[model samples]
Target: MVTKLPLAVLLSASMLLSGCTVVDLDENGQPILPKDPAAKASFSSQTPQQIAQENWDSRVLKGAQDRALTWNDMKNKSTALKAETSSSVFVKATGTVTAVSDDAERERLLTVTINGESVPVAIGPVIRSNAIRDAAGFKFEEFTNQVQFARLTKALNQQNVQQLPKIDGSWVGKPVQLTLAVTLQPQRIEDAVAVVIKQEQP
Candidate 1:
């Protein structure tokens, strides 16, 4: 005669046969599974752009206070003050447009003076630095080359010029505010080769 197994034994045997572990359930009956080690590893290895994007709202926006610096302060105190004041290499400066370059190259330059020091802002047809990508939290590595960079910058430049039509000429001598992405090697700050310029409303 065949004998029936106990309900507990039957359940245990079924679980063992299926190689399944008991899943803990929440009060609402949702199964809770262990976090995947691979996913955790992948998250930890996220790219700079990804990390920057994730922290953009908190770190770049709300956490860090805007520090207004003169061009001289930027030239002299960029390294020291940046470390003490903010986590980002980006900064905001207000000044009069003392000069603007007439170069028709993909990269255009604008010079502004604050406290008699000149700061240059580059608007691009060819954006070379990763400054904007880092500052704006873009996935630049996905583009990977000059052609892609050129395409992206061209599109950006077209859109920006529409808003500030005469960025090179009309904006000169006007009091303006700029949010720039700075680079220490050559020691320059620019418009991130995009729409980083704003004319102070009268």
Candidate 2:
């Protein structure tokens, strides 16, 4: 049925559509602004892409800080090998390395310190994150805080950028699963493995 619309409704819709039109300073009057100059200044900002990039970088840095781990945290927790042998032998290192030859490798070198009498040795393929948990219902992500990362940075020589392996997002809180690809001497590997097993026991 034909009906007459109220003049007020029609005028309001027209005003809204007109407001969206691009106003040219050369043609239209100086850009209409709020009573306060500061409020108006903030409106003329960067494009959407620039804003998104800024937000992404901020989140990435925060995530890196959140997931960062310390040397001791990585040592006591992520080491595949750790044991209180006859001698208090402890090997804690964090970094990435590339094999040079059958018997040689280049270590970017961050930090390494041992308390007991032992040869200073290092191996790579080391990637760690405090984002795991254990069967005992222990959460490891708690160890990835800033305090831990600072300690790790002080103790181990790590690369400028440490890349962690992709873990199933679902398994984060279920069990502690850390993957370390170390190229240790056979004997050292055996020792480290023994230590790690002992530590994990119970």
Instruction: State the lDDT of candidate 1 residue by residue for 1-202, as single tens digits.
Output: 9999999999998889899668999899999888764443322454434544454545444322353334456566445544324322456667788777675776677878765667666665445655533444334344444455445433433444444435667778898877665544334443333235778898
Winning model by lDDT = 1
What is each predicted model's overall lDDT from 0 to 1?
0.55, 0.30
lDDT tens readout by residue for model 2, 38-108: 34222135332333244333433343334433334434443544344211122333322211222233431
CA RMSD per model (angstroms): 9.1, 19.6
List of clashing residue pairs for candidate 1: 106-125
Model 1 per-residue lDDT at 112: 82
Quote the lDDT for 36 in model 2.
53
Q: Which stretches of candidate 1 lie over 4 Å from their true place?
A: 1-77, 81-88, 137-166, 185-195
Q: Would you give me the overall lDDT of model 1?
A: 0.55
The candidate that wins on TM-score is 1
